[model samples]
Target: MKTPGHIRAVSRRTVLKGAAAAAALQLAAPFIIKARGETPLRIGMVDPLTGAYAAVAQNEVMGARLAVQQVNANGGILGRPIELLVEDSANDVGTGVQKARKLIDRDQVTFLIGDVNSGVAQAIAQVTNEKKVLHIVSGGHTDTITGSDCKWNVYRVCNTTSMEANAVADLLFTKYGKKWHFITPDYAYGHTLQKAALADLQKLGGTMTGNELTPLGTTDFSAYLIKARAANPDVLLVLPQGSDMVNCLKQVAQFGIGKQMHVAGLQQELESLEAMPPEARVGIWMFEWYWKQPGVSGVDKFVAEIRKVNNGKVPTARHWFGYTSVHTLAAIANKEKSLDAKKLAEALGGFELADDVKLQPNKCYYRKGDHQLMTSAFVGEALSQPAGDPEDLFRVDRVVAGDKTAPPEAATGCKLQWPT
Candidate 1:
């Protein structure tokens, strides 16, 4: 009941009308104050920002932030500014979950983009499923994300391990006629990748000389290199990420693998090789999402912008992946004009960005069956540039469009489905 004074001030007609309106306004004030405390769009990011894949994580963050900037510049999403909340997982599994919880409970983020490592992605997926929160994985691409553990709230924006492993492995065998041996880390990323590569190699009529799974912290590859040397395979696919890749490639010249081995995957990322000496990383083949090649959508502008931001030096390929992932988030948020996680996940199935080059219409989609994205993968070769500059070390040798690499539906073991 409002006071007589409030009733009188509210209206001439017994003041009942103004009393109700005044009471409602008083009630709304608390909600308005609380809303003001929260960010415009609660986007939580968990990544290995301080550890092995920090460079990749940083690149991904830059890309995501760029999307946020672009979206806000165009009058923001649904007329509301988006605020991205980031937390470092330090590449630790426990930290990944902890950070995710903070994002969900404290930051109140409606959606999330993730840890650079597959392990971190896996852990976060479990948490989101349990909490019924949405997770859009931009960096992690392990099969497990879309595999057995794929959850209701989880959707991936990158290819799975099975996709890359089979695609790259088969590509090498068909093109290079592989008598293959592998040098991969013993951890999940390396092992899962090696398994897929080997399977594809065998399917393509290639002989697998053998494989050696080096220890996770094996800084010195002399022993592993010695083993690889003994195998004498035509293809030497290195599956290590982060400093492991850079370190191993540096010593590969001494092992003479460069003389006879065909490098692919991580060994072929141009930025990693730019730090390497000639012959140490040349003719290296690697699979990727985008390169500054003509006809590839969004590549030239993205590359130019990144180069401009990095001051003429090129951003790491991982940076571009992060870049694309960020824009994807903004698109989903802007398309349905909602910050709600479920709506964004549903919108993801048929989503397309007018500016997205790597993802094309109809052809590009998130596999409703497994929650995996069908993104084009590029098989690139390291250019033998004398300058060995970070920006000029590699060029797209082959355009392995998404259509060429995707396996038949009967092949993948995914059981879950999404609406058309």
Candidate 2:
């Protein structure tokens, strides 16, 4: 019924109102986003939190939690809070792979950390590599993690068996005798560790009295001890780790084997030493980290912070491994200002940890070619009695730099291939 001009006017008014509403919504968009908050960056961790490595694995988690707290308190990665989700690997490879897939596919984690057991670590690496997730091997020490089997997306914070062996080989040969026997674990970790040690011993003109391969979780070491004692080696290298090490060392002390021959090992953990009796703690070994470094910068603060969460127990190398792994992701991502896996991986090629994070006297950095952290080894002997502090169970004889202990990257056989 209206005139044509009137109808046109009404349509123009409606159009203007709609345009005004659209402008208002555009103005409100940023505030709505701000109110909704940013999505938190998720990190997945897998470890043997329930099995033989539970004690050490839990310590690693504790360190990781502390790192997350510290990172959020400061500004977090890419200005978003970090959420760490941990899964128990149960010290089994099949279970570890399943958990890794769950973290990658179901939980949608941006970064991955895990596995005190080397076999489980390698299995998890396959998943991480396929998914293109950034992964840091927190405690697994098998050489292949950073050697022949190394992946572009994977980096290791712990020392390889070859590094541990090289750290103490000369000292063991000079101080102890040249004749040696081994109580090695029957997994990839023990196999490579024994091989590396044997190579070092042969190079030093040492003789192997005998070598015994003990299966993982074997509680009865009596038969192995009998064979070792019969051989009458100058040194007995007890190489089993976690609960196995505790059982073997307890039996060794019970048999009074330390009194007959020198007891030594390449890599030893404070978690194992604390679980053992004073007599069973007898050993010359290398600690990837030690808490009682007198003159080292940042060591005191790190120890104090860990004690709050650790029931006043000191931080072990496993703890440092977890802390460094989390910090590695945050530090590199924040520095590069991007969460892209390839970009971050390239940034971390030769990244040096900060002084506070390193906590050792020597320089600590990742080797560019292999992505293995060149952290200092705390070479020392276990103390029967507390040196000063109740938790001080080691007497650090030397702080050897990792560069000196680790072989050349070319020698490691690591060839990193990036996704095309």
Candidate 3:
């Protein structure tokens, strides 16, 4: 006979081998009492660990792992060691829901964080909300996470499509050109970003020459490249992400289209860019975080530590998302003096954290109306001439304030509900 919410727990130090090993570790007692007389603070994380987005996902998990170690080293949250139980979402909506339920109902995780795919994130959100568990969207970028589909217990750390579009439109239009063409993934996320980008660019006297809707995980973009080249737009905005992004850009360069037209996009992940050769990496794009920005307190220390752990490989924005998500939740839990979902929700509303980035008035917060994290958006250009270090790929040119980047609260259509 096994008890409910019983999953074998592993310490922060153990490396989870695979899904089976991770599941095997979840035997009974999801919330394990340590020999130190303090119960563990469990956090369940689900993401696409082995799929098109696996490289980016790996960095995201590393970020969370670093944060967990940092939190535990500092006496843990509220004097209890934090235990992280991870599940591979596999980039499938059904798998995401199953994992979410397992974490909530069986593992009894204190809260949840996840999901790279917007669709998968939404599916997991439903489960966490039903279980009354607080979840932070650490990587998902679809507008619905903080829009009409928002839930009371859910929060988003990543910028919405509108946020990225609004933030970078003017900069890109002015710097690149006013005439644009799009290479978008034929999916909800791509459609949302493409629509937002077009709308924002149009406001600045920009015109869309063409938009090529490519299926996700497309390998050969020769046909799309031919269409984009013929359209002869001033800027080619590649809107697909993850492997789609890597593939399209590489093919674009190979097709010699990049040489004729300026290349750009809505968002970029350093991990994704690292996968491509320097010759293949070209374009100006939106970046949520950069490891080498100047005058930021604790950034150098973070970069140094991550580099040490990853054999001198620098951390990326995805890593920061995971690191920030865990630390922010733990901080809020400590501040509210409890991990109750309702209390945490109330505390997060209008809560402010002073970030050292120095770009956004040194502060970021969750909007009371939408639970969207108000933070700066950065524009980075892949350097044409490498200054030697392969990691020194992008040169961050501008950092837009969050207030200036995100749309007005009334326009977002998020109606948050609080407990009685």
Candidate 4:
């Protein structure tokens, strides 16, 4: 556990030098703003093009595209259309760094949105700070990403592992009568989330039987599954995403081990559920940002339009995450009333979102305390397919409010607070 003083909400240090602190201001910078003859709001989204995470990368690209269309249809950001440039980073750290440089130096994007891998996001954050470009991350969640590597130039809009812990921490332990074990990827994000979840579980009177950290692309999980089943824990937290998740489920089902323990965690896309056989995925639970929970205003239309765009097939959760982040970014720039990165960042601190369909506009604001959005996370269970449904998949089971699950200032492990 982080020491009581380790997760300080008050920013203990300053890392952001002002935009004016940058030495070179281009002559075309003035023309880049579009709304009122300011710089055009040039944004870039860097994602994987060819990798295990390709499907998710494509989903992010599509979502950003949708937001650009929506923003333009509604009269673009400020006035000019949000000119977005997308580069394929292929989930490689070096590739993401190179692409970020190209986006900032050659393409002159005012802000950026992606780089799916945490390592890449960290590298890109470094470059963005040196060049003074605002990088809005929709992917990449590690405590240290916002902890030690944090900078004012970088902001995360996705549910951090912090939020996921609050969403699922005591859920299985208390409600489902589950004592837990963790199977996590051997990286910072996975380990961090696992730690937080375990801490939360411990706080709720649960104990972890054991945990196993596996390599990134390990395909065969027979050994791990056997060990987990042998432990006989009531529930398992499987936190791998992409192909690794698909393979783990297949192997878990092949051995019929999940019957011994319930499986639940944060899932990447709906496609992961579809990737498995019926008996394998039944009753598995997960959390996402955009499932259509009951009475969730505007979700039906948002899902409908998304299905329409995808040839009547439901869009993946990743697609909605990317789409929503783009809208959030555009809305912040809109609130800023200019394309200035600093202004947008300043306004992001006070920005709020109502829903997926932009209805009932609320005074939603990003807590300057930690740069986390004051929003909600949707938790869902795998549902049994009805007789005539198009597919057997998961639907949202509950909505967890951001504030409800929000960790206090002492939990983020962040040292810097935004300017109030």
Best candidate, lDDT: 2
Task: Give the clash count for model 3.
Answer: 4
What are the per-residue Cα lDDT tens digits for candidate 3 across 1-420? 011133343342224354322322332223333427788778988888777777677667777777776667676778787777788888889998998898888878998999988889988988988888999998888888888788899998888998899878887899889999999888667788998999988889889999999976788889888989999999999988888788888888777887899988889887668767677788788888777776777788888867755656787888788888888887888888887899898789888764532223346788888898987887878764668766777887888777778888888888876556
Query: What TM-score fits each model?
Result: 0.83, 0.91, 0.90, 0.83
Per-residue lDDT over 55-150 for candidate 2, one digit per residue giving the tens place of the 0 to 100 score: 788778778777776776677788887767777888899999999999899879999998899999999999999999999999999999999999
List, residue by residue over 1-420, the lDDT tens digit for candidate 1.
111221123232212122222322232111111233333655677877665565566667666655555655665556655656667787778999998898888767777888778888889887877677778787786666677667767877766666676555655676566698778877667777777777777777787777778865457888877787788777777777776777787788767677776665532455456556766665445556544556656666777665544445555556656666666776767677776666677677646545463433225666655666676666656665545434566665565555466565446665654333
For this target, which candidate reaches the highest TM-score against the unseen true structure? 2
Error of 3 at 258 (Å): 1.9
How many Å off is the CA of 234 in candidate 2? Answer: 0.5
Q: lDDT, candidate 3, residue 120?
A: 91
Which lDDT tens digits does candidate 4 get at residues 13-99?
Answer: 111122211211111122222345534456777877456566566666666666666776676777776666667777678889999
Candidate 4 achieves a global lDDT of 0.65
TM-score-based ranking, best first? Answer: 2, 3, 4, 1
Kindly report which residue stretches of model 2 are placed more than 4 angstroms away from their true locations once superposed: 1-36
By summed lDDT, the worst window of 10 consecutive residues in model 1 runs over 24-33
Off by over 4 Å in 1: 1-39, 174-177, 265-267, 295-297, 357-363, 386-390, 417-420
Which lDDT values do the candidates have, in the order given?
A: 0.64, 0.85, 0.78, 0.65
